[model samples]
Target: MVTKVVVVVVVVVVVVVVEVVVVVVVLVVVVVAVVVVTAAAAGELVKVEVVVVVVVVVVVVVVVVVVVVVVVVVVVVVVVEI
Candidate 1:
């Protein structure tokens, strides 16, 4: 019974992570497309600014995702240990 519970938990975590990854990828693609279109019409300075902003946003998102995954792993480990 404990093994079954752990398997379910692991499966759920995997599904959630996959969904998050898909969403992030879609968001990044959309943002990049928008930035490209805007940059084409805007000046060089604006393009540089947009690029910087995109980089910062992506970095922040990656950090958040990493933290979430770490927390989830810790929780799972604790649960299994119990």
Candidate 2:
């Protein structure tokens, strides 16, 4: 019974992770397109700013995903022990 529950949790986590990754990838592509268009209309300064923002956003998203995964793992371990 416990094993089945753990397996379901693991499967759900995997699905969530995959969805997050897909969303991130799509967001990056869209952001890149917007940046390119804006830079072309604006200038080098704006391009640099946009690139910096994109980097920061990506980094933050990665950190959040890592933290969530860690928390889920800890919860799963606790549940299993119980």
**Candidate 2: lDDT over CA atoms?**
0.73
Model 2 spans > 4 angstroms off: 1-20, 23-27, 39-45
Q: Which pairs clash inside model 1?
A: none
The candidate scoring highest on TM-score is: 2
Alpha carbon lDDT of each predicted model: 0.73, 0.73
TM-score of 2: 0.52
- Worst 10-residue lDDT window for candidate 1 reads 42-51
Tens digits of per-residue lDDT for model 2 on 22-80? 66885788677877787787654455666678777877876787778777867876786
Model 1: per-residue Cα lDDT at residue 14: 86
In model 1, state the lDDT of residue 19.
Answer: 60
Q: List TM-score per model, in order.
A: 0.50, 0.52
Off by over 4 Å in 1: 1-20, 23-31, 39-45
